[model samples]
Target chain A: MMEQSKEPLLEVRDLRVDFRVPGGYATAIRGVDLTVGRGEVVGLVGESGSGKSISMMALLRLLPAAARVSGIARFDGVDLLSLSPRELSHIRGGRIGMIFQDPLTAFNPVLTIGAQIVEALQLHDRNLSGKAAWTRAVELLAEVAIPEPGRRVHQYPHEFSGGMRQRAMIAMAISNRPQLLIADEPTTALDVTVQAQILELLQRLREELNIGMIMITHDLGVVAGIADRVMVMYSGRVIERGQVDDVFYASRHPYTRGLLAALPKLDGAREALVGIAGTPPSLINRPAGCAFRPRCSHAEAVCATAEPPLLRAGQLESACYVSDRLSGMTP
Target chain B: MLRYIFRRLIAVPLLLLGVATVAFFLSQTTRGDPLSAVVPERQMNNPEIVAAAKERWGLDKTLAERYVIYVSNLARGDLGTSFTTRRPVSADLAERLPATFELVLAAMTFATVVGVGLGVLSARYQNGPIDHFSRIFALLGSSLPVFWSGLILLYLLTVQLGWFPGPGRLSAHTPPPPPITGLYTLDSLLTGNIPVFLESLHRLMLPAIVLGWSVVGVITRLVRSSLLEVLGQDYIRTARAKGALEGRVMIHHALRNALIPTLTIIGFAFAYLITGAVLTEAVFSWPGIGSYAVSAARALDYPAIIGVTLLGSLAFLLANLATDIAYGLVNPKVKLQ
Candidate 1:
């Protein structure tokens, strides 16, 4: 396990979000606690509607008005949720940047690529002139490895290819030199080869700028190489968390083990791939205790009676009642 | 872009011709003698007078022959003389065209400015008091008939409170300014006649508001719904994430996309206003093409009816062309070619 000897750049504690639905409130994120040191990459892995993205969005207060978010997100010694909207706006793009899943939809169709980048730059820096911002935008585009930045900067979003648009999205995100970045499934919509390039670009940027990043994705392979720590979420709750290497090789939670087993191996004897048995429980009226009990192969009678709190065993923290017994077994 | 515009312009005459042909045949279907409009009721029994009047107006020709002659005359830019007015239909329409254009322009401007403003406000504060009030206002505007609303407003504002002019484009004694654009307000401004300009605007207020009320409802609903949809777009989230203030996020990112669909509705609304001004014009006694068309219809003046139909079709065709060009300009994905 990596030692946390230094002050964390971002520390989130007991983050919760509930959405107002037709009849009653649906708790999307029950309670999520995480910390990211400077220059560290944290991977949040979960299925769709698992509240992985919602937790990050809640930190930035980016969710719709229907969502009721309550959380303590401390960034650079400031409590983010307590700040006024005007004060929060400065921290949003100035200190903490975010890039979404779909770059094509993330960009305004009418505005040029350069204009969007310039907007981010100028929003944080009041004295920056338009011409200087444009020049800086082109430089940022080039920094993201986009070719012919001079000509491409003036073109509209629809004129660019999907990969190029994602590159531009990255360019805009990092334009302000934010200290922390939240990338929500950034490469999910990209091609396989393009995905590698984007991941590489993100790693290089994080290294050069020493910015802490939270990489959210559903694919286990996506986080295997990039993240320093891996957090596995199921049914809106974090089921397991540990150093990336330990979690991959010695995961304790049944859900995490199932996810790792579901990954297709490049070199192995041919065999049928295994998938988790059941779908996630509905949020409105979740099962009495463990939300994943129905899908868990190692579920016990105690799991249905009372929810298990996250218990630490050396380097890993797991929320399963049978995690201790399962730790002794092998694949 | 130029090529697209040129192609659209080329179709204008063909569309006008189609409207003209339909109007001609439809007028023929109405049970009426063309010569009765010109010859007096007493003179209708006199065979010599009726024959001479029929021959003079070419009503004596067979239907097919007259159609051929009508088409040829239309090709030469000649709308047949109106049997009721004893004047060329083109000349009469030319004189009234300016009045209708002025009124429609004023109403459209009013509707667009106020409607879009209300829509933006309503969307910005969804479920708020402002949103509720604007929605109720829109509902009433769309549901209430224009003539009834015009009369009510006229009585309340003009008769009860005496806050605005009753009706007409100007007071009874005011001589119209020199006809530069034939729009009283513009002409008065051009001639540096501020009093005349204010007087023309004063008289223009109530009728324009009454005419534009229904359109305002449509525009508000369209813009409100469109803006609400755009607010949920990914780009809007990106803008907000970029530290843009709520105002800047709305105006810079959301409004542009929201207004694209609204522009199409506005185009059709403008065209509708031109033709739909008939009832509004009657209430106000405004000397515009709509009232001219009404009078022509009553007299069964086929030539005048065809002329007005051509004008209405032209307005629709031009509005559609303008909308297409606007779409190309605002959305980069739209290829003009």
Candidate 2:
């Protein structure tokens, strides 16, 4: 058997997403550059308030009614922003699948899992008959390792256990077998064991299906386990980008360091885990200069003077003005 | 489901008892007495005649005793004699109910077909010109007085245009069909008299339309709003995502759930059709309960007034109860709750 070569399946470049606030417009995603090659997993890590989810939503043009997206979100050389509602609808579930965060709240409560999955299949492939659609739906459910797939397929979303519902969501997402799968906090609401199993299932599926993925999560541990590359976002801007190991072991950005330090090590080296102090800046009225400058301990006058742009730091991109200083090199 | 029925069954008798008690006292308390209408012109000022009338009708007894007698008579389907008509109240209701029912059925058919169709179409094409127009139409339909509308229709369609008959259930020249049932439409149909049936339809059409216009308006708005809300739900999005066609998603997924609220409105509208729109009945002089009740009031026929009022109230309550059961059946979530 010949080895398949890796190539970019999805690319988002210089993307900006803005929303009109009370008296002014607030940028939800500012000049984010990201890529997910075929058979690769890239995690988008940020806190609750960060625009990681917004960026993903923008890539799919799935933002709320108020959002205004610009720049390029290219999946297979086709710009998403330029597509009409009809064209976009074609790609949404047909080509690029999305799994929402909360499984319990994701699926329509009234519809049976089989019905939802079959609807997705029938939507894209009109040639597939009803019997064929149901058969394929059952196959997809079984592929997701749903025990008693035949019986469970007839059950509504609420009938299933939480983990089972999440699996059903995955089944629905992948029923069409799209080129790229966007899993947004797919296991955030589950127990630890279920989370591990789901992540494992996702990771295994990525390899087996060779479909690209953009996994968005707040936990760095999730990125470490599944992501080949990781991007760190803060206040609607990408702060750091690199290979997972480069970003994790040798983080050169101050915010990245603060985030890494905050992670509770599984080895229990510390009796109590430390957390990053101070709250995330509000998008409605952001402060001048670097958004993170107020929270940085090594802040100098220059740090607060102007907003630092995301620039290349060795092999990775770092937005800090003092990336060298954070890396222990004098400017 | 059985639990709901059991609850309603227990409530019916209690409600009927309350209605009976209120009717007995309200009649007693009212200024004019039933004997005032029953006594002949020659005996207008005779106390002996008034006392005889009261005793014959059993109205001279204490209120509680009158209620017991009323309840017992109602159990045996005896609604007492109509004080003004000198006919049995039950006979009057039996003669009149079928006519009203026919008119009501016609109105309901018109309302359901037009209102629900317009509503679904409006919601399906929300904010479009059709939706806007339907909304405006519903507003106008709801706001117009039924009696005024009926009068205008009579003038335009019957009096001037000569497109329909102005009033009554049949043409005077037609030998009144053998009166099997008082409802001319049914009797005409049973004897296979096409012209008579068609003529009866023509006479009833304007009144039904006038009465049903508000119902159509209400049902349309109810269906449109309910469908719109259902269309915007996440499951609808999920259905769309599943690649279900827009029509399928709407009809199969959104519409059925939306009908829960709509069914309630439908029940209320049906009840209104049965009891509301008194003005339209009077305008056309169709001899339905609306007109009957009015004449009964003017002539101080207490028994007839009480019977009509109780019947109307019963229809309203039963319609709502049926709506609840329907709502439960349509959505299992509602049933569980």
Candidate 3:
């Protein structure tokens, strides 16, 4: 059933991603559904093996050839999967931009930053002259607060430090004023200070440009700072979804609770941090029913026998049968 | 750059010394003799003529004495006299060197332009019909024996097709250009003789093509693989995500990164052009060093053999040196290290 309300800017429904292995097929992402309104920042939080990156890559149809993805990913009411490669390519950078995690490996070291940025502009607008294109590039670099934009424009990616490279990457991503920006763990590799600065820049750009974004991360702190709404994923499926405050303060899913409990407190308290037990299930041979039932403290016979659907739990929606376990309503 | 050249200059003489030592011993110990090839069997049977020949050529001295004289001559830029022509060996190589240089230069120019262009097109439309066609053509060039290909081209063009002449540098009827730099093309161009220049260029074209075709396959594969590797890097994806045209990504973002490895392949290929294409030159009778070296080895002309061997070794050394310098230029990591 569809929601009888204002249409969202991007809507993904019942998405399934499976891969062919040597023995048989293995499903990595199983029926994940989420949406983002225009100008909203949606955080996709999960541990390393939770398929957060794959789901984001799936939206762009950018996964490997072996990946078999099915379901609807509608962007501006256009089915992204249904478009031809040519149309998809035109949309890939012009409409929906992506910023990868590693800044060091994210740029071609030999080319000048100006040439790289100008090329991005020229791809869509063939009528622009080289001088105009270069001027636009310098302007974009300046927007990103890069010092001496004109002088730094001619410098190669290797000439800049890590933080500068990240900024240059940001300049390239937002140059075309894309509608949707996906930043996948963009600050995980940088130091704490640089990470905070990049997050701040991203939040500022999101507001100024009024663009929708899907920020993928395993850290709850990142989600806490910038996310308007949050989707907690476990083994490629959406386990919880709601407003960021409701999801963070009133988390119903055990995985979400575990992720929150695992976070180290910033306050100067000497309490021991509780770590999540059990390794993530391997994609090659996953368990039946609820994937996280074995690790859930409140799991029962019903939890292991039948997979729970994404149903209502207080203010948030979660895919856990024992959602009321912590509330003492069920035993 | 200075340090790189210094390292290369030091390495060159050591490489030459190793090559000279090998060439000298190999020439001495090989099946045939310079005496038999030059003196004739009848003249060699006469002891007085043989002794006189040995003394005059310094063959009567100990091996150590000959080596000392050999190194001293090398130091003085003297390559010694030829056993067959009874002329200074340097003069013979010098006469042939320009022709070889001219031919190699033409071949390299043709190969780089055609091969790299084809590679870019193929990679851009990868696995498409054009890519398939290009890959097949490149494979044919790569797998075909160069000597056989040369003969086939000769037969098809000269005998069957009747589109071109066979087995010569230029037309026999025309007067040879005034030896300005010993390269016919340059001399004719310098003298402003269009007809002579055209004639020389036309003849050079086929030999160059035959040699260059093999190089085309090598460089195309090199560029294709290198481009493919570079294309998969995060920077290329970032470039694409930034709305850079696919063409721009291929050329500006991908190709520069690709050139690093491709350059090393090209340098070695050029060095190989000198020694390995002997059959192609022999088939076409292009009068390059390849053909001359083959005969020099057969006749056991010690000086000619030594000179050609040393030059070939020097070519390899210089090629490697050039590759290192190019590597430093292309890769920031290399320069930093």
Candidate 4:
């Protein structure tokens, strides 16, 4: 799996998203590049306003009226952005399934879970009968490990608990057996126990279904176990990327280092977590140089004037010049 | 659900009592003494005759005493006699209410079909030519006065072009079709009286359009905004992400949810069309209860005014209840709450 897999299943290049706000255009996604090989798991890690979700949404052309997305998102050699909505409809839930955050509000309250699943199944395949769709929906629910799939499918979204609702959403997303499954903050709304369960369910589904996935989350702990590769994003740009273990053990960017330092360490002697000082820069009025320079502890004279592009360090990619300088410093 | 409805039902009588009390007091406060409306001005100066007329009609009683008498009569299902007509207000209401309902129902149909269609279209093509047209159209429709529209339409279409009859529920020659539903159009259709149905529709057209025009604006704007908002919901995006056809996404997902607020607007709009079409009815001379209420108001017929208001309040309440049930039906979360 670590071999340089050529011709990835999904490839995103130089994706940029801008929204028309009151004063002027606010750039949400500056420039992002991502690729997912067949049956591979790529975790996209970022803060709330880091454009992780927006960039993924732009892949399927799912942004709203006010948003303007410009990019090349190629799924199976087809450019998604070039396709019309009518043409894109074939690939949206058919080839690329998306599971959203907040499972409680994701599913339509009025529609039965079975109905929603069946509708998704039948949308792409007109030949599928209602009965067949219903049966398949139950099977999908069972595949997601939802209990009493037969009876529970008939109930509305509110009838299910948070974890069950998220599982039901997974069932709906995977009902069509999409080649690329994009789960956006899938377990963010659940309790710790339920979050683990949901993550396990997602992992199990990935193995059984063998579908390529792009997992978006802010929690580094979530990415540690599941992700094959991790992409660290800051101010709408990919700051660093590499194998998950390599990036986690040898973080290159200052922002990634700050993020890792802030997380509570559970192993060995406990150390005080180093808090990252500044908040994420506003997209409307981002600083000219490196977006994280204000918060970077080792920021020098050169860090403020010119932005540094992603550069190869030892194992992971680095977007800051001070990576070697930080590594040499004594604790 | 039954308990909920039963609780709402219990409030009905209490509400009716409040309405009746308000109507009674309002009639007393208004100008045009009932005696003066009934008797000629030449006979008004004669104090002896005025005293006799007051005694006969019980206008000599205090407001509280009159109210007690009105309530007692209402308990027995008797609406006291009209000051001008010398007939029970109940009989007049029964005769007049059907016309208002017919006109209002027709207007509601027109409003709903036009409004919902325009709304969905506007939302689908947001900021397009159709959206611009609908925005301007709704603005004009809502801003234009009902009586003004009614009069202009009546004058232009009826008096000038002669496309429809000027006024009245039916022509002078045609008697109302056999009273099956009390609605002439429905009764005519049921009885297979095409001529009567056509005539009734012809007379109803101008007034219905005028009354419904403003309501159409309300429903259209409500639906447009509601649909735009609902289309932006997570569920709607999910539906689209499911590769569902745009039409299915718009109607099945967005429209049904959007129609929740529009449904409430439609129900109250229907009630308002019936009860508040006083000027439209007058302008077109369509003899619905709206006209009856106006005449009652003009003639200072206290019992008649109170009866009309009481009936309007009842219809409005029922419409509101129906709307709530519909809201629950469209979105299950509401019923659960």
DockQ per model, Cα: 0.82, 0.33, 0.51, 0.70
lDDT of 3 by residue, A23-90 (tens): 88788899989898878999999999799998888877777667899999999879988887667777
- Model 4 C-alpha lDDT per residue in residues A58-162, reported as the tens digit of each score: 888888878999988888878999998898999988988999998877888788999999999988899999999999988988888888999998999999999
True contacts kept of 3: 0.62
Per-residue lDDT tens digits for candidate 3, residues B1-337, read 7975886698778778888888887777766656776666878789999988888889889888999999888888888988876788888888787778778878888888888988888888788887888788888887888788888988898899977776777878988799999889999999998898988888888788888888888888888888988888888777766655578779878998898888988889888887766877888887878887888878778898888888888888988888888888887657722
Model 1: how far is B337 from its true place, Å?
A: 1.3
Q: Please tell me which predicted candidate would have the highest DockQ against the true structure.
A: 1
Please tell me which predicted candidate would have the highest TM-score against the true structure: 1
* lDDT of each residue in B276-334, candidate 4, tens digit only: 98888888777788888888877888888888888989999999988888887888778
**Clashes (candidate 3):** 0
Candidate 4 yields a Cα-based lDDT of 0.87
Provide the clash count, candidate 2: 3
Instruction: Please list all clashing residue pairs in model 4, or write none if there are none.
Output: none
lDDT by residue (tens digit), candidate 1, B1-337: 9999999899898888888888888889999877778888988899999889989988888988988999999999899898788888999988998888899999999899989999999999998998999898888888888889989999999999998987888888999999999999999999999999999988988888888887888899889999999999999999989899899998999999999999999999998778779989999999998999999888888899898888888899999999999999998889998
List the candidate 1 regions with Cα displacement exceeding 4 Å: A1-5
Off by over 4 Å in 4: A1-6, A22-24, A268-271, A326-331, B29-32, B43-52, B60-64, B159-162
lDDT of 2 at A116: 82
lDDT of candidates 1 onward, in order:
0.91, 0.82, 0.84, 0.87
